[model samples]
Target chain A: SQTIHQWPATLVQPVGSPLSLECTVEGTSNPNLYWYRQAAGRGLQLLFYSVGIGQISSEVPQNLSASRPQDRQFILSSKKLLLSDSGFYLCAWNGGTANTEAFFGQGTRLTVV
Target chain B: AQSVSQHNHHVILSEAASLELGCNYSYGGTVNLFWYVQYPGQHLQLLLKYFSGDPLVKGIKGFEAEFIKSKFSFNLRKPSVQWSDTAEYFCAVSSSGNTPLVFGKGTRLSVIA
Candidate 1:
């Protein structure tokens, strides 16, 4: 079975600090990885998606960026965090060729103070 | 780009009550639909998906959804909901097999005894 791992479960950082969230997948290769932000009533907002290593597609223009350094390793990073950047960040992956449902990792609750 | 709409913000229901959560997507071309559930402290899991063929799709926990292409709608339903069904439900859509998914404002379901 495939599984996704994300960390840290909760993060508290001061404003203008750097941010880094990591997500890794096991039991699958060449999977499609995605980063999403879950808000109160706004639902899951797509931030970035990677099809392969070094290939990333961003949906929203914001202070965050994503990198796929390996086939199953994805990282979400920001040079400087903003107050608005604090939210529930979720990492997900799926088998691209099957058009299947995505599997999510336990989300990271980021609090930018 | 594809966008998804889930109108219900919160729904409270008693055990055994029927459920029908509305989901609509805006995309003219071929699309893939999915429903995901997130328990109180867990990651998101696939509830059901409709890629092609048979408009009605069945998923785990007695959950199902019907895709009505003419109406551009994919509504999730359950014959009888249980207390365990209390969670957040999200609708997602993708333009192709390899594209990133667009999610809607999620619906929070709270089932009581």
Candidate 2:
């Protein structure tokens, strides 16, 4: 079975601080990875997705960025966090094909004060 | 660009009540639809999906949805909902093949026992 791991599960950081959230998949290779943010009482917003290593497609323009360093390792980063950047961040993976379902990791709740 | 619309932002129901959540999409081409559920403090999980063939798709925990292409709608249903059915439900759409999904503002279902 494939599993996705994301950390830290919760974080509290001051405004303008650097941020790094990691996600990794095990038992799968060349999977499609995605980053999503869910604001309180709002729908999820796709932040970034990667088809392969070093290939990232951003869905929206925001203060965050994503990277795929390895086949199953994805990272979401920001040079400086904004108050608006605070949300529940989720990492998901899917089979690299059409009509496939996505699997999600336990989301990270980031609070930017 | 693909976009999804979920009609209700929040719903409150009692046990054994029939449930329906409306979802619509705006994309003129081939599309895939999905329903995901998020339990409190847990990761998002796939409830069901529709890609091709049958438009009526059944998901876990007695949930089902129908994809009416003519109306560009995919609405989730349940004949009888339980207290455990209380959760956030999200509707998503992806265009054609190998595309990132677009999500709607989720519907928060609160089923009282």
Candidate 3:
């Protein structure tokens, strides 16, 4: 069975502080990884996605950046967090093949104060 | 590039009521569609998905969605929604094969008892 793990289920950081969120997948190899932000009414926003290690495609222009250093390890980082950056962040992965469903991890709720 | 749109931003319904949430995507070629649900304090879970074959796909929790390629629509339906159905729903789309999934600004379903 495949599973995803995201660290720091909840975070509280001051504005302008550095931020780092980690996500890793188990029981899967070479999966397509993704990062998303979930807000109240704005829905889920795609932040970044990686087809493989060191190959990342950013969906939006923002302060956050994503890196896939390992086949199953993904990291989301920000040099300086802003109040607007506070939200629920999610990590997901798929088989990178046809007719496959993506799996999500327990999201990280970051509150920038 | 692909985009998704969810018609309803927020909906309040009573238990046992019929429910329908509209979803549309911007892409002409082969595409995959998906629906996800997020409980108040839980991760986003896959509700259903459409890749090939039948246009209509049934999901967990007595929910379903229909895909209309001509209309570029994938609308979610529930014959009898329950109070437990009060959660946020998201619609997503992607190109066939290995491609990034794009999501919409989810619909918030609040089913009252």
Of the candidates shown, which would achieve the greatest TM-score relative to the real structure?
A: 2
lDDT of 2 by residue, B8-102 (tens): 99999999999999999999889989999989877789999999889999998899999999999999999999999999999998886678878
Q: Write the per-residue lDDT of candidate 2 for residues A10-110, one digit (tens) a residue.
A: 99999999999999999999999999999866789899999899999998898999999899999999999999998999999998875788898898999
The worst-scoring run of ten residues by lDDT in candidate 1 chain B lies at B94-103
Please give the DockQ score of every candidate, comma-separated.
Answer: 0.75, 0.75, 0.75
lDDT for residue A98 in candidate 1, whole number 0-100: 40
Those runs of model 3 whose alpha carbons end farther than 4 Å from true positions after fitting are: none
lDDT of 3 by residue, B9-93 (tens): 9999998999999999999999889999988887788999998899999989899999999999999999999999999999999
lDDT of 3 by residue, A1-113 (tens): 99999989999999999999999999989999999998877888889999899999998999999999999999999999999999999999999774677899999999999
Q: Is candidate 1 or candidate 3 better by lDDT?
A: 1
**TM-score per candidate, chains pooled:** 0.96, 0.97, 0.96
Off by over 4 Å in 2: none
TM-score for candidate 2, residues paired by index: 0.97
Please give the ranking of all candidate structures by lDDT, highest first, separated by commas: 1, 2, 3
lDDT of 1 by residue, A1-113 (tens): 89899999999999999999999999999999999999999999999999999999999999999999999999999999999999999999988764787888999999999
True contacts kept of each: 0.78, 0.67, 0.75
